[model samples]
Structure formats: structure tokens, C-alpha cells
Target: MIDALSPLLILLAVALPLALALAAALPAFRARALDLLPFAPLPSLAAALLATEGARVGVPELLFGVRLELRGEGRLFLGFASFLWCLAGLYARSEMRGTQRPTLFAVSWCLALAGNLGVFLAGDVVTFYTAFACLTFAAYPAIVSSGTEAAYRAGRVYMVFSVAGETALLAALMLAASGAVSLSIGGVSASIASLPQRDVVHLLLLVGFGIKAGLVPLHLWLPLAHPAAPPAASAVLSGAMVKAGLFGLMRFMPGDGALGDAWPLLLLALGLAGCFYGIAMGLTQTKPKTILAYSTVSQMSLMVALLSAGLGEGAAGAAFGALSLYALHHGLAKGALFMGAGLAPLARPGARIGFLALLALPALSVAGLPLTGGALAKLAGKMPFSGAAETLVTLSAAGTTLVMLRFLAAAGSQAGSGSERLPAARLAPMIAATLAAVALPWWLFPALSGQDLGYVLRPDNLWSAAWPVALAAAGFLVWRRAGFPAPAVPPGDILVPLTAALERLRKPWAAIHYPPFPKRRSAQLRARGMKVLLASERGLLSWSLAGPLVLAVVLFAALYRP
Candidate 1:
């Protein structure tokens, strides 16, 4: 029975949410779409639980033969990502109630859910790229759903980075597919080592995916987007969506030493830099969501560093398991934390203490407190490193602790500020995610790490997890006592300066106007054509048309290809 159902499950996992998103396009279904949000990811979650590894469903006529397959790593990614999306969807159902643009949010949410889950199950280059592009364009509306200037600004910056990243990824995928006999991701992976332009492919993949993973310098969109988006949107943006890039890197990059040591070393260096850079910038922020966004930057960098270490030492197999485990741990904990931030303002004064305590569970888990899933994840992440590198990773926990501590403080202060009472619909999803963050890793640790529960609970292992958090807690108290002697670095730290520089450059260019075009008969005809093209361009660039226009172009390209 399970065998017969596997292919159906695989197809439904991607198809169901997509179907709902299309239904949402109708005027009759528009208002009802919000009610369907929680159900959109059910097929994906069911597939994650029931589909056998390596089970696949393929379509010979779709986008040069599209396929969806379940591998060990992909299964793990699919499971957690689907789980997070489901809970986040529930949270959004409550959080977005009676908002200005329910239809838009509901449609974008369903489409992004489909695309996010599709990336893990995608078996071919075209399928993966299509899913990725779907996710990239679909998420823009949610980012700007608040209809605030800040939200709009963040959405603009997000699009700029997203477009550039997508362009690089498309070029890289085309190059990778050029040398492969089959269109399957596995086929491309097998041929990557022998490709003539493998080095360039690696570079493009890193930059393209690095932006999504929130790596340093390329991560400007995250801090801004998180603060401007709705809490549930922020949850998936940090927790589940960012993992798409890490998944892409893991899937596409060859670990066979084909690209030499320089790439891995460069990755390692960038990761380490982001680890510290995120901490430094996070400490200056007061918004709970912004702080969590920077925390994501740091945690993701650590995972990337671990991957680089594994690649450098030829232990990529073990690293893959550890990376998946770490990603799952972070996704649940961070999702819970972001939702908790939304719930904080609704807590009654009488229940404020209890609310903070509940919020602290996921926050502490993110800091790698002993007896939590994060402890197991941190231990697994450490398995690939030794010497100074391992020590640095261990100490980074202290930084995580400080940032999480700040989140708790910020959230606590915001508690009971909303006029409305807290509802179970809003609270239940956060609580469920919190419980999963603390409990699920213990159940899965043995399978992923090949170690018994006793190993994680051993005195030495407990001490390794406890000390950094303890030290950081003490430091946080002292810093609080000393009045937090840090400068106020704005969110999107580097973007502020870069924008100012661009404005300065633009002022000079604007002042230097060129002469008008000659008025010959041929020039007049050409000018008329230019006017028509410019008007069309302006129409396509409008906010309402941009996202769907891009989605249409991507789908057209995918379908038009052999």
C-alpha cells in the first residue's frame, strides 16, 4: 500500500499548494483563500512522513522532463521545512485576520509554500530552478503586505538582491546542464567535476545561494525584511526559506576536491566573518525580530563554516547529516521565537511573566542550552571541526546567547502592549513549535549521529553545552548593569551607506544632461519605437505587475525549453 501511494504523495506535495494558489486567483475564491492557508502544506507534511527515500515521480513533457525524488538529506529538509510552513501558516491565519490584503497574503503564502517545499523534492535542474524562482517572486508580496513605507523599502532592496541572485543561479544552472546527459540533479552533480567551467559554476552557485543563506555582505536584505514583514512571514523567511540556499549549495557543489582548496577556504573565511559580524550588529538593535534576523545570519554562517570544514577534510558525508540536523534544529527554534515575538504584545498584564517564561524556552534553545535540541545540534556541528576552529565555533554560542538574551528583553518589554487579548489560535502554533524545537532533536539524534541518548546526556557533553550559555548569561547581566555601552548601528547595516553613496553618484549624473537626438525622418521613427518600448517597460515595472510578470517569464522560459 505504501509503495503504491508514494508516487501520488510526491506529486501532491508540490501540486496541492500550487492548485490552491491558482484557485486563489479567482474572485470567488479570493476571500476564502485565507482559510485554506493551514491546509496548503498538509500534502507536503504527509509526504515527508510517509514517502520512502529515493521514491520519485517524473513528467517527461514538463520543462525538459521534470522529476521529484526523495533522498536522505532532501527528506530531512522536506520534513522540517514542511512542518515549519504548516505551523507558520496557522500563525498567519490568526495574525493576519482582517488585514488589508488577505487575498494577496494568502496567495503569496501558498505559492511560497509550494516553491519552498518543491526545492527539496526537485529531482532535475529545471524543476529546482523553477521552484526557486517561484519562491523568490512569490515571497515579495508578503514582505510588503503591511503597506508601510518601511515595508515597501525593504521589499525594494529585497527584489534588487533577489533578482541578481536569481540571474547568477540561472546562468550557473544552464552551464551545469550543458555538460550533462540527463537533466536530473544527480546527473549534473556527477558531471560537475569534469566540466570545463566548473570553477566558474562553483563561484556563481556560492554567490547566488549565499544571498539566500544570509551570508555576510550579501545578507543586507534579511535584517530589513524581517522587521518589516509580518511575524509569521519573518518566521519562515529566517527558519525555512533561508535553508533553500544551503540546500542548493549542498546539492549542486561537488565535494570531491574537484575545485581545489581555495573555494572551501574562501567559504570558511566568509562564514567566520559573518559569525562575528552578525553578533556585532545584532547587539545594537532593539527590535526583537531584527535581532532574530541577525541571529539567523550568525547561525547560518556557522553551518556554512561546518560545510566548508567537511569539504576541506573530505568528510562531506558526515557533515551532510550534521548540517541537516542543525538546519532542522534552527528552523523549529527560530520559527517558535518569531511567532512568540508576535504573541508577546498580546499577552495580558497578569500573564506577562508566564509569557516571557514560555518565550525563553525557544530563545534558550537557540543559544544551545543543555538538554535541548540545540545542544545535540551544536555537538553534531562540532564533530567536523577540531583545534582552534572548533573552539571558535564553541565560543560563538556565547554570542548567540547574548543576542537571544537581548531578544527576550526586547520581547518582554513589548508584552501586553496590544489592545486585543491573546487568542489560542495565535498562541497554540508557537507553543507547538516550541515543543518541537525542544523534543524532536532528542528523538532524531541517534539516527542522525549514530549515538545513544545517554551520549548527549553524559556529564562531559552537558558541560560543553552549558558553559558558553552560562558565561554569556553572566556577561549579559554585567552588560545590562553597565548600561549596554554599544553604538546604534541601524538594521541593514551596510545598505544605509551604500544607498547614500549611490544617491551622491546619481546627483552628479542627473546634472550632466546630453544633447537631444537629431530629428531626421529615420530618427523620428526610431524615437516613436523607443516611446512605445518605454511605456511598456513602465507598465511592467509597476508594483502590481512586477512579481507576476517575472513569474510568467520564468514559467515561459522553463516550458519553452526542450
Candidate 2:
């Protein structure tokens, strides 16, 4: 029956890449497997599409009684994550061909792929943590794949934050698990409130997950890491891997659990701040990838705002539906846009129009243009927002619209210059991913959220989505006519000052290991210190000196009262 095969399908999706990763250890297999890198995610794609409902599977011997399950948001995440991975793999195949050390890239890709898939399917705290750790560490090589100074610097920044986030996550997990009677995610979430230090646990979880979600202050690494990685790796990092953090929030804090009202409101405030902050910073960037990275930060903030509002209203059903829909659409759309960044410069003169069209579809969708996936995602997500919050949500759309327009302008200029044409290997994946971004949401909205297509197509609903984008377009035209200069902020604006501070501390840190004392003074100081220490030791060893000291200490202790 279909039910029995679903678990098997899910297992194969994970096992395929893992098996390939093991085989990559052999020299002959490594060379041959390099060619098959593009196909590594095919089984996962099939599993996502064919597996109907949720299923649970256990692998006791492999992972300490590890349990994996597919259901609800997990299913949606697996579907979209797998879809993006497949598209990225295709893009990588064309981009990485003829490059040295293909096996290195391929193995890293496989490990990351397996870990990304595993995060979505993991059913218990231990399983989820294991998958999360794997994803974090495995993706490092991908970020540093360029082997440039920038790439190495980005890798260090990424590892520093990743390790910090994991420390917080481990602490939170241990706290949540301590009160849990059962080890499954559901059991831990339900039992978290009973712990003596539940508030501390909640804060730690927020910090851990928020760092991965690219919440500000903790978000500097994202822009740095994304731009440093290859296009394929960037696509997954932004589109899929970041969602793992959001997934943790949903899993660990389902139905608002014990977070109270304060946490959700705080998340909302942070989200709104990031929404505008990201756009302001992004406008100054020259690199298309860096611009896209900031756009992601802004978009994720909107999702956090949505989740926070849902928690505030206590409408778990509608909030989760909207969350899943938005995440799914954003992941696909962002993946397509990143892939397009790589292909944009390669558009031939003859196919230039077609290529620009491909880029525009997802770029506009990211702005929530009418009839696009972004519109549906925003619509579904904003159902719980009303009054001023709702108005701000609409205005945030306009701000995103402005950012996307700027991205297109930059990408267009890049397309204007290159002579190389996009070959079929590269072109096919771009087209496929873009089409999916545009059309899949139309199919998925009704299925995932159970809203009639007519509801989304209603005159009022269409107008709600249209006005923000329309206003943004008019504003953009006026701004263009006025000819305001784009501000020049460094790629990681906050990182520059932080790096300088670290540089100032470098000498002090080094001095601890290798002191700067002159040799003559050092010898004299050592001899003098040794002589004083020996004299004091000889005096202390004497009963006459020791007894008086002991008697004085006791008298002091007895008379020490104020």
C-alpha cells in the first residue's frame, strides 16, 4: 500500500546521498561519482512528491534509537527543500564542470544534502540536533569552496557563530529534555513548561534559533557567508538551510507553549526592525549576491513577524498554514533568483530577453506581485495580522518591492556586458526552478491551506496584494527621476568595526602566549621572586611562625564581626 512505501521512500531520500558520501571515500568511486553530483537529490525529489502523508521510521542501530517522521510542516519543508536542492545540484553541475577538485565539492554537497533532508524528517530532539549539527559543519566546506581570502574569512565568521548557536541549542535542548517524560519532539515541547527554569530555556532557544534565522545583531554572518559561497551553495544556504531554525521554533514552541506574551511581541518588534533595516542596507550593495542576501534577511523577518503574531493571537491553525505556505514559496523563489544570478551574465544576445524574463519572474514574485507565489504567501501569512500590524505588513511589501527593483537594476547591468551565452546545461535548471517558483504555489495553496482558489483570486484579495507593489513602482519611478545616489556601506557593515576591535586585542592576546619582557630584566625579576618565595616558605615552615599565623587568623576570624 502507499502508506507502507512512504517511510521507505523517505529513508531512501536520505540514504542515497549518505551512501554516495561513503563511496566518495574510494579513489575510483570518487572520480565517477563527481559526474553524478547533479542527480544526488533526485530520489529526495521523488520522495517529496510521491509520499502522500506523514510517516515514521526508526533506525536504532544507526543513531541511538533514532526516529524520523514526515508530517505537516515537515512534509512541506521536505518537498520544497528537496526541490531547491535538485535545482541547485543541476546549476552546480554546469557551473563546476572542468573545475579542479570536483570530488571535494561533490562530497561536501552530498553531506550537506543528507543533513538538510535529515533536519526536516527528524522526529525527536536528539535526531533533530544531530541533523542540525551535521548541516552546520558539513556546509563549511561549501562556503569555503572558492578558496579565496574572502571565502576563508567568511568561513571563520560562519564557524564562530555556528559554534555559538550550537552551544545555546545544546543547553536549551538539555533543559527541555530534563522535564520531558518522552524523548520525541512533541513530548518535549508539551513538557517544557513544567521545568523550574523554563524561561531561561525559552530565551536560550530563541537566541540559538534566532542566530540561524538571521535576526539582527546575530545576522552579520549570513551576508558574509552567502556571498562567499558558490551560487549553488548560496541557494541552499538561503533557501533551505536557514529554514531549519524556523522549523526549530515551530517544533519546540508549538501552540505558543509557555513563552507567554512577552516573547512573541519581542519577536514582532525585531522582525519589523529587520524588515526596514535590511532594505536600507541592501540598497548600498554593488554585488548582486550580497543584495540578495539582505533581501533574504528582510523576508525572514516578515516570516518571524507572522509567526509572532500568530502566537500572540493563539490561532495555531491559521498561523502554521500561513507559515508553511510562505516558507515554501520563499525557498523556491529565492533559490531560483540565486541560480539566475549565476546565469544572468551568461545570457547570449539572442536569448537575452528570455533570460531577463526568467530572472524577472522570481524577482518580482519575491516582491509579492499579483498572481505570483509571493502574493499567495503574503496573503496566507498575513491572515492573522489586522489593524496597524496589517498595514505595516502591506507597507513592508512595498519596501521589499523597492529592494527587488534595485536588485533587477544591478542584475540587468551585469547582463548587459557579458559575451558568454547560457548553455542548455545551465539554462534548463534555471527555467525549471523559475517555473516552479511561479506556478507551484498556485497548486500548493489550496492543498496546504485548504482555501479555495477563488478566495485568493477575489477582487478584494487581489487589490490587497496589488496596492503595495503598485505604490512601490510609482515611488521607484519618482526616485529614479530625482536621481538619488546609492549610499556606500561595506558588505558587512557592522563587521568592519567588530573586526577592528578584535585587531586591537590581537597583540594583548598574543602577549599572553609570547611575552615581550627584555631578557636581562626577566632574569633579574625571576631570581628576586624566587628568593622572596623561598624566604617566605622557610619562615612559614617554622612552627614558631606557623603557630602565630594560625592563632592570628583564628583571632581575626573570631573578631571579624562588624
Candidate 3:
């Protein structure tokens, strides 16, 4: 009975959200769709809690025989991701009330939720790519939901990077699939390491997933997107969606460390660079959300470094549990911070102190304060590091702390500037997310790390976590005394100069006009055909058409597979 039920749960996890999204796309249910948003992720949450590890369901009729499974790390990823999505959905319903294009936002939310959950449960390469594509395309509407110029610009940037990443991933997948014995993700991952073009495959995978994970230089989309999106959307964008790239890396990269020394060393170098670069850039930003976005870049880079260390030592299998724990801790805590930022402006003057204190809990946890989940996560990640690497990892906590302090100050300054009282609907989700961030890691730490609470509480371990936060606090005080002398670096630091250069070139190019060519029958025919193709492409790309098409495909796979 248990075995039979597990597969059903897995099927429902992906199906439920797709079904809701389909309903949301209809005219009759469009207005009520947002009301049902909170319920869409429930099936995924249930699957995460009850599905047995190693249990899988296969749908052979689907593209290249789709498979869904729950493994140890996948289960943990699903659980935390589902939890974040559910809460974020509720927050969205509350925050986006009376906002423009409610139906579009609702459909996008459900489709993106389905895709995010599906990525965790996908057991085959095709299914994984399908889900990833669904997520990448569906999330664009949410980024531009505000309908502002900045929002549209951010959406465009997000799409350009997402398309590039997906294209790279598709090429890599095609090469890997050609050499594998089966289409299973595990099989393909194992075979890729032995393929003749292994080096090329590895580079493509890293560059593809690295974009989504906000690795340096390629991470310009994140800081822009987060600030432009609604609070709930930003929460999931930063908290859960970015994890898709990390998940992709973990799933596709060989666990046996067949990536060779160059790949691991290069990854390590990039990770270390991003860790500090995010901090340096984050310090110059004024917006709380942008600061948090850069913080994600740092934290995610640190995780990549941890993964690289494991690969270098041929112990990636051992590193998986630690990476999952760190990801979970960061996801929940960061979600809380983003939600808190949304709620801050609504706080009454009398409640300001309580709000700040609430915000600080997750911030400190993120900074690795003693006994918090972040500390345990930090400790687990440090297991594979030593000497200079360990010290640098520890010092990063100080940088994270300084950034968190900046975020707290920015959040506090916005209090009482909006409505006189905070709405319970909005307040409840942030508080719940905050408490979960603090509590869930403790519950899962022993299972993920194989170490008891006492080990985390040891005197040496406590000291390791405390000193960096202390140093950061002291440094923050000193910096505050000096009135924050750092010059303001514009958000999307590299993008600013690059955009200016392009604009300069565009003006000169536009000034030099060419004479019109003589019209011919063949040229007219070709032009007409091109216009027809472009029109069809635009229609297919619109949410009204694309959302249902994706849902229809997944629904058919779920119901028709023998």
C-alpha cells in the first residue's frame, strides 16, 4: 500500500499545480484563481513529507519516457521548496490583491510552482529539461507583473540570460544523451564523465547552471529582477527558483569527481571570487531587496565552492548532504528576509521595534550566529575544508553579517511609510516563514549531517560561529559611526557601463543610414514569410497561449502514460 501510494503522490505533486494553472487560464475561474493559489503547492508538500526515498513513477508515453523519483537529497530539496512555495503563494494572494493583470499573475505563479516542484522529482533528462523550460519561461511574467519600465527591463534581461542558459544546457544534454545507456538522469550523469567530449560538456553545464545560480558577471539579472518583482515573487525568485540551477548542477555533474582537476579548480576560483564580489557590491546598494540579491550571489557561490571542494577530493557523495542543508537554511532564511522587507513599510510606529527584532532573527541566522540553523549549515559545509579555505569560509560569515546589517537598517527605515496598520494576511506568511527558517534546520540537521545537536553545540563549534559575527558587528558599528563612507555603486554594476557603451554605438550606427534596396518578387515573398513566422512566434510566446500549452502537455503525460 505504501509503495503504491508513493508514486501516486509523486504524480500528483506535478499534476496538481498544472491543473490549477489550466483552471486559472480559463475566463470563468480567472478571478477566483488567486484564491486557490495557496492550495496549488499542497500536493507537492504532501509528496515531500510522505513519499518514500528511491520510489519512482515512470510515464513511458511522455517525451523520451519521463520518470519521477524521490531520493535523499531530492526529498529534502522538494520539502523545503514546497514549503517556500506554499507560503509564497499565500503571500502573493494577499500582496497582489487589486494589482493589474491578476489572472496572468495567478497563472504564472501556478505554472512556475509546478515546474519548480517537477525539477526536484524528475528522474530523466527529458523530464528535467521540460520542467526547467516550463519554469524559465513561466517566471518572466511575474518579473514584469508590475508593468513598470524597470520591471519590463528586468524581465528582458532575465529572458536573455535564461535563454542563453537553457540553450547551453540543451546542447550539453543532447551530447550526454547520445552516449548514455539510458535516459535516466543518473545514467546520463555517470556516462558524461566518460564521454570523449566530457570537458566541453562540463563547461557547458557549469556555464548554463551558473547563470541561474547567480555566479559572478553572469548574475546581473538577479539584482534587477528581485527589486522589480512583487515581494512574494521576489521571495521565491531568490529563495526557491535559484535553487533549480544548483539542483541541475548536482543532478547532472558526476558524483565520482570525474570532472578532472581543472574544472574543480576553476569552479573553486570562480566561487571564491563571487563570494567576495557579491559582498563588495552589496555594500554599495541602498535597496534592501538588491542587497539581499547580492547576498544570494555570495551565499550560492560559497555553496559552489563547497561542491568544488568535494569534487576535487572525490567525495561529492559525502558533500551532497551538507550542500542540501546549506541550501535549505539559506532558502528559508532568505525568503523570510524578502517577505519581511515587503511587510516593513506597513508596520505601525509602535510595532517597529518588534518588526526589526523579527527581521534580525533570520538575518543573524544567515550570518551564522551560534546555535542557529545557519551555524549548523556553516559547520557542515566546513567539514570538507581546511587551512586557508576554511578560514576564508569563516571570514565570509563576517561579510554576510555586514550585509545583513545593512539590510536590517534599510528595512527599518521604511517602516510606517505605507498603510497605518499591517494586514494579517501579509504578516502571517512572513512570520511563519521566519519561524520555519529558524526551526526546520534543527529538526533536519541530525538526519542530513549524522551529527547530534550536542556536536553543533560544542564549545569549539560555538566559538567558530560566534567570532565572525562578532567581528562583523563591531565593524558595522564602526562603519556606522563613520557614516557609511562607501561610494554608491549602481545596482547591476557591470550592466550599467555595458548598456552605456551599447547606447553610444547604437547612435553612430543609426546615424549612418543605407539606401533602400530595389524590391523584387523573391525578396517580397521572403519578407512576407518572415513576418508570418514572427507573428506565429509572438502568439505562441504569450502567456494566454503558452501557459495552457505547457499544462496540456504535462497533463497528457500524467493521464495517458501506460
Q: After superposition, which runs of candidate 1 have C-alpha atoms over 4 Å from their true positions?
A: 514-523, 526-562
Worst 10 residues of 2 by lDDT: 547-556
Model 1 TM-score, 2 decimals? 0.92
lDDT of 2: 0.83
lDDT of each: 0.89, 0.83, 0.88
Error of 2 at 508 (Å): 4.8
Number of colliding residue pairs in each model: 0, 0, 0
Q: Write the per-residue lDDT of candidate 3 for residues 94-190, one digit (tens) a residue.
A: 8988998989999999999988989999999999999998998999999999999999999999999998888778778877987999898989998
Ranking of models by lDDT: 1, 3, 2
Q: lDDT tens string, model 1, 1-562? A: 8778888898999999989998888898987877788888887788889987789999888876889988879988898888998899889988898999998899899899889989999999999999999998899999999999999999999999998899879878877887999888989877877888888888889989999999998999999998899999999999999999999999887775655789888888899889988988898999999999999999999888877865754677788888889999999999999999888888888889989999999999989999988999999888878888889999999999999999999999999777666888878889999999899999888888767899998899899999999999999999999885778999999899999999998998899989876679768899899999999889877767585467657756865956
Q: Write the per-residue lDDT of candidate 2 for residues 1-562, one digit (tens) a residue.
A: 7687877888887888888877776787876756666677776777777776767788888765788888878888888888888878877877877766677888888888888888888888888888888888889988998889999999999999998888788778877887898889999988877888888888888878888888776788999999899888898899999998888888887465356788788888888888788888888888889999999888888888887866754577678888889998888888888888877787766776777877988988989998998898888877888888888888888988988888888887778456766777767776787788888888888865668899998999999999999999899888889998888988877988999998998968777865598999999999999999999878788755585466547546754998
Residue 156, model 1: lDDT of: 98
- Which regions in candidate 3 have their CA more than 4 angstroms from the true location? 518-524, 527-562
